[model samples]
Target: MLLFSPVLSLLALSVVGQQFTNPVLWEDLADTDVIRVNDTYYLTSSTMHYSPGAPILRSYDLVNWEYISHAVPRLDWGSKYDLTGGQRAYVEGIWASTFNYRKSSRTYYWLGCIRGSNTQIYTAPAAEGPWSRKGTISNCYYDAGLLVDPDTDIMYVAYGNTQLSVAQLSSDGLSQARTQNVFNSPSNIGTLEGSRFYKRNGNYYIFVTKPANGQYVLKASSPWGPYTSKQLLFNIQTPIAGGGIPHQGGLVETQNGVWYYMAFVDSYPGGRIPVLAPITWDSDGFPVIQTVNGGWGASYPYPLPKRVLESPVGTDTFNSTSLSHHWEWNHNPEISKFSVGAGLKLETVTVTNDLYVARNTVSRRILGPASTATIVLDYSGMKQGDRAGLALLRDQSAWIGIKNDSGTFRVIMVNGVAMNSNWSTRSTGSEVSATTVTGGKIWLRASADIRPGSGRQGRFSYSTDGKTFTTFGNALVMNNDWHFFMGYRFAVFNYATTSLGGEVIVEEFTLTAA
Candidate 1:
């Protein structure tokens, strides 16, 4: 006899054959939409206000992925995205979206909303793109998904919340032709969003998610009206231990039509992170999430032949003219204020009391259950009032950096620098620990504990040499709230408390997690 346990959303188990764990990358990849091109799989997800929005990932097998390029080169929606005049666009910009390939045009489409404005559209010929904005939908299509009929080339966008709506796009897919209410959740279901529109066996389907956690699908014979809804995934346990329920993602079909669903779990202070699960359609034409013992398993057999691939997290040597796709500017950066060559040179671009208002801070997502980010800084050029170093950036943030106070360089760790009033407003955090040093070159680190619960903290450390590191400050309890919408990031920043022009050179950056 074989002993068995049903709820396997925690342990990494091997049922019969080779298996891989869930929360796929253990990185902050929320609101994901995936598609397949030839033998490769492409995925893009929400980046909120992070410039170079919608990061692209490539996978030979859905179980492993690599950073390829970003779909949006810049978040040029407004001046606020550039952090102009201390205006910020946090929790704004691109949200949930669709990634589709139009075979007729031989182009890839990226459709999503910009803030509360109209739904914006972007297209590219290739996945690693020079993506360009084509136009926008007349009305805001929040948390939308796209489906273009191959036979007719007619485009349809499923959008809206509890009161769902489907907007028909012009034949060219550049504008809206018509909009209609398709389905509405029962008053009991509350909010329903994150729709991924699809068609199969002559039936059109709209997959949607209900707040915090829950999923459902609506089916109709015609594109518009008379749609019927059915619950799909509601009480699925999170693949990540102690994480929130998984919901709000899109489905993709393999080359041979094997299906998989890529969704995210609310695993903060790392924010919502993506997870993968096999799915199958039933005789009734509704989708079902395949799991072990009627629950989401922490590990599952690879849907495709598995391959050992390098993760997106690794060292970035500043040898290329442009930063790697792994990095995103906090907002649209001032191009003239930064460059990459021998090393990343970031000139102080803003005179601000808060890091929130500082421009040109480039960052990478912090991995979980825990991860360590390290950066080597050549502070030979740091000027008075300039603060430059490694940070765990969010609304409530902390950092270990070199702060020049009255011409004296102090290696310090600051905590509780928080956003207030609004996303654009922030208070200057206090230095929790400091040590004077005649700075030349230094190393800084932020090891984050981003597991579930409120005890998450980022421990700060520093070193004169690359090796021997000394603890800098009391561990900062990171903010784990849905309010930020985005997760904590390892940011390389430089800003001035007085005048700009002071700069710092980041020699190298590396990240590792377990």
Candidate 2:
């Protein structure tokens, strides 16, 4: 079904040429690493417990990127990854990935830490992957970076807490070999990790972050070596109101040999968003962000090249036969429970009352500051005791949906606030409202006004006729707690606690930003 879509037009115009400003991507794509191969650029980042773990993004220009695919379909470490045996792996699936491609073997490799499970290596022929797992290495190097030396074809990984080290890997990039201490950051550096390894100009460079001290660069003549480090970005300026402290990302060079450093800042509500800074090399062959007065500024008038890829997050019409790359489940999605044709059909999965623990809840990051998301849900197939809704997912979230009891139905709105910072299922403040419904379909909208000084609040509304929307519940204070460690997202969920076979069909979802 070829529908007339503005999204496709956007993709075309973008490829012709488009410019972007600071904080290029305003979504929670944290712990990012980038690499350029020929005219295309590929990126990998930490999804942390989100299945289809280790998302790989593709870009033509460094500024605009699209979600291409994921390295792992689902983590199979323990019962936690499957949400079975009453176990969960929240904030622990995959973290801080390093992405690389080897021209000699024409293989793409991704190395990421699984926290308690150990570091995993995933490989694929092309970046958009049917990636094969290369088994796990016993080391749990926090925020580890992987590099395959071009000359020697030897793999090396760098990681640590306060004191960092580089360890060698076997030829096949499977197991670890000898280890060597690399750099020992000073105590005052404050929160140092997220290492990304690079080899250039016959020298090995490691880009790592020190939260309070900014981003640092460590250089060594040998992959396994005694290295010297220097501060790359300190007191860097940010263009956005609440954006600064650019740290934790990898570097990429454009087709014209122009280099740029892609990093992230602690942008709350939107989580850690991507930042692009122009980079140049020093006389001693050190990469430095183009800055005035020896410090990188908040923003630059950088001219970006263009690509024809769609933006990473936006509206989904569900008119296609398959789901788009913009969507990802909260965990490994139970694909058997979902189908798509005219609209997205999500069958109910029997689970607890907590939405976080429920399976098959697909989500996309909130494009923030001020944005509104609207979805049309058809609940004609809902059975008694079935709960289906459009949710703004975070520790603190609210949803508006339809609840059916036998032949009777009602539109219900629920607001929940998490108690613990861990973003667990338990919530202390939860409220609900119900109104009699006369039809089998409804349109729900979540409008957020998170502009820096606006106090970051999200409000819920519903429309039975799809034109007039009525505000239903209290404002949800957009939360930025450390435990959730991320931003809110627009999610569609249908679950059953009493029985099975209930389903919800989402016609379309539109996300508009101011």
Candidate 3:
């Protein structure tokens, strides 16, 4: 079914030409890396234990980027990822990574550390792929940068914090040949990390970050270096109001040799968001963020001259045989638990009172700085003790939905449900109103204010009919903490407090600018 969509108009504006804006991706796409292979630019971001970890996004013109595929189809790290025996991997899986395209072998490499250790790797021939797990490297290189030296076909990784280390990888790219400390920071510099390795003009450059507020360049003749360091960007004013400086991402050279730095700003609630800056090299071969009054510009000319495509979330009838690529499960999903045909039918995979541990809770990023998602939920299938609905999902979450309270149907608004760092959850998260509803079909909508600043809140509303909605409960504060790195998302979830067979049918979901 072809539906009139606002996203189509946004995509069409690019025909006249599009501008590269700050917070280019307005959601939680953090700890990013960008690489250009031929005419296309591919990006990778830290997925933080979410299934389909380490996402791959592509931009034909660098003005509009769309989802390609995830390097990790599932977080197959261990049983902890499966919620087996109540074990959880929250904030544990994939962290900062280095993504590269090697021309000689015609492969794309995605390498990162899980939970500050346990280095893992994945590779594919194309950005969208049949990916192969290249296996874990025995050495733990935190926040790694992979460089396959084109001159000699040797692979090297620049990793670590404060004192940076470079390790030469084996011919097969799975193990380390040798390791050496290449660069170190002074006691006062604070936390320095986020390394991206490169070779340009017969010299090597490793871009490193002081993660929270600064970025620096380390230069040397060899991968394992007695390297010299220079400050690149430090505490620069952010174009985003009340946001931190842009730091910790990758630098890419366009097809025409123009350079650009794609970094993320630690804007809480909305999470760490990607911001692009045009780059130029100094006479001494140091990279510079082409600044607007010594601060990154809010908008600039498009980074590349290519086709324009912006695939933002839009109206969905839930009629597709398969769900769109924009959707991702909370963790490694049991595939048999959910199906998309006439509508998205999510079968509860586990008997859980907490939504955080509930399996097959499907989600997608919210459109910012303000937007709303209205979903039609067919609640006829809910059994006793079943709760299903729409949520502003995070470690701290809120939901508005239907609860089959001992087989008595009710529409409720629940807020303050929080998950502990240890994976346990508690519900200060409560149903404020337990009003009985007349039907199994209902509509729920969440309106969010995600602009960068302190203390943003999300509001929820519900409708017995599709057109009219009643603002339900008190707006809940959103999680801006860096520890809850995935940020807030719109989730469609169904879980049972007593049994595992109950389900929910999401007939349609429409996302619109608020």
Candidate 4:
């Protein structure tokens, strides 16, 4: 028998209590939608310009998740060309997708929107599988919604162009069978989209959200309109409001027969990031969303089923034959640039000369509000012009590089055509004495802090022994553009040089939340 002290018993109870507390924030998740197949929960989100168009994440509980695999290899649309200038088109490919599980067919269907003109649908037998493109929905419509009638086996797609419209799909869940003009409102609820259809107590409910405003729940007897709009689900004028104009989500009934609405809110500086909210129905059968700070709502503590995979940090050893899912390329990764043997060696390849084309660089978004990432590399046997260092790259215009040439370290900031020196914050570069590395292991670390209004900025440190570190002068500040993509990234680089046969070897990389 074991004897327990009072302090020990209290600590044990505290640990058990923590398991019931849910997470407040979901980092690096955007345009999220979820579905449960069997006992496992599957989630999908828009991947935009990011190499993996549709990100498929798995979780046992909604709070904890891990990157499983991508639904699409690359965006069906062309890269950078598809984006509006200065916007983060790369991160915006398949926005607001709907995931449905068909028990009759034993398959999972994914319907998502491209940039313009029509929604794209994909299907796979299993949650984790090889998904194939079924084709595009009629004309270009964004933020599509799909619902299947159990009695009729008919599928309908609700989308908005200049106005919201409903269209019927074939039995195979491909192509439109019939199209109907749903509803059009000029003001207050103009151009409403993200429509979800549900039936309860003989009445059909269609929930749709208007841009930069609030969400409206419309009721009708038939699937096609002659619909009546109800009070706004959320009022922005309220004291504790939901942020970033209400957006689309799904109205789902869990196995326990409780109803909930999943939606997104633009809470960050940019109104693009997605946040989850819990919903409840009033006695009158109208849905209402609980708002926080008159902004986006917080996630609920719903006891839902899920399949969680807590990924291990700092596992990009490159010793395995295959790359881990933890890594994501900016756009499409050049598979030939990397090789894993005794260690990982990234060959210097021709990156896009234009900043927009540099999406091929592989990176992972900083997962926490603040984090520190470190990489160990061997940059020996390089000439004066030959440069290799860890880079904090955002775009062509905004980035900072810490490069080593011959025996000296140089810190550089790239802003448009100007490369500034750290000491003066002016366009210049000053050389410093080279730090010695034994066993070919040179450690480089960067720490980023995400602050409200101030944006994210951090310092870079270098160490030879991996223990003692010296901060390289000057903090690199990331651009505070919420409309565009924002995240701290770590990367190993090899630039063009006249000297031939110079290669940079990366031994290991680690990212830890501060």
For candidate 2, lDDT tens digit of each residue in 1-514? 2232244433333333334577787778888888888888888777877777778888777776788788887787777776666667777787777878888788998877777558888899999887989878888767888887878888888888678889898877778877888778876666668888888878999888886437888888987667777888776766567655777888877778788888877766767778887889998889978864555455555444444456433557787777766677877777798988778999987555777777888887778667788889999998888888888887777787787877688887878746355546667335567888877889998887643332678888999999999989777777764456666778888988678888989988887787
Better of 2 and 4 by TM-score: 2
Q: Write the per-residue lDDT of candidate 1 for residues 1-514, one digit (tens) a residue.
A: 1112222233233335888788787888888988888878988999999989999998877877878788888887789999997588888888897878888888888988887678888898998888999987769988899898755788898988888999988877888899999887888778899998988878899989987779988999888958888888887877788789989888888887889988889988988888889899888999989987777888888777765454555677687878888889998999999988778999999997788888999998988888998898998798889999998899888889998988889899888888874775566789899999875899899899888778888898998988999998898888877787898999999999888779899988878776
TM per candidate comes to 0.95, 0.92, 0.95, 0.78
Positional deviation of residue 251's Cα in model 3 after best superposition, in angstroms: 0.3
Q: Write the per-residue lDDT of candidate 4 for residues 61-80, one digit (tens) a residue.
A: 44456666777755656534
CA deviation > 4 Å runs, candidate 4: 1-25, 79-92, 196-204, 235-247, 267-274, 290-308, 311-314, 340-344, 351-356, 380-440, 485-503
RMSD of each: 5.7, 2.7, 2.2, 6.8
Residue 146 of model 2: what lDDT? 80
Question: Model 3 residue 269 lDDT?
Answer: 82
- Deviation of model 1 at 398, angstroms: 0.8
Which candidate number has the best lDDT? Answer: 1
The lDDT of each candidate is: 0.85, 0.77, 0.82, 0.57
Candidate 3 off by > 4 Å: 1-18, 421-423
lDDT of 3 by residue, 1-514 (tens): 3243544443334434666677778878888888888888889898776778888898866657888788988888788888667788878888888878778888888888877657888889999986779878777789888888878888889999887899998887777789998777888776788888988887889998996889989988877777888899888989788888999898888888999898998877877889999899889988888998879899887765535564465678778777666777787888898888788898878787788888888887877787898899998888889989999988889999899988788988999899877656866487776678877899989888888776799999989988888888888788777777777889988988888778889989888875
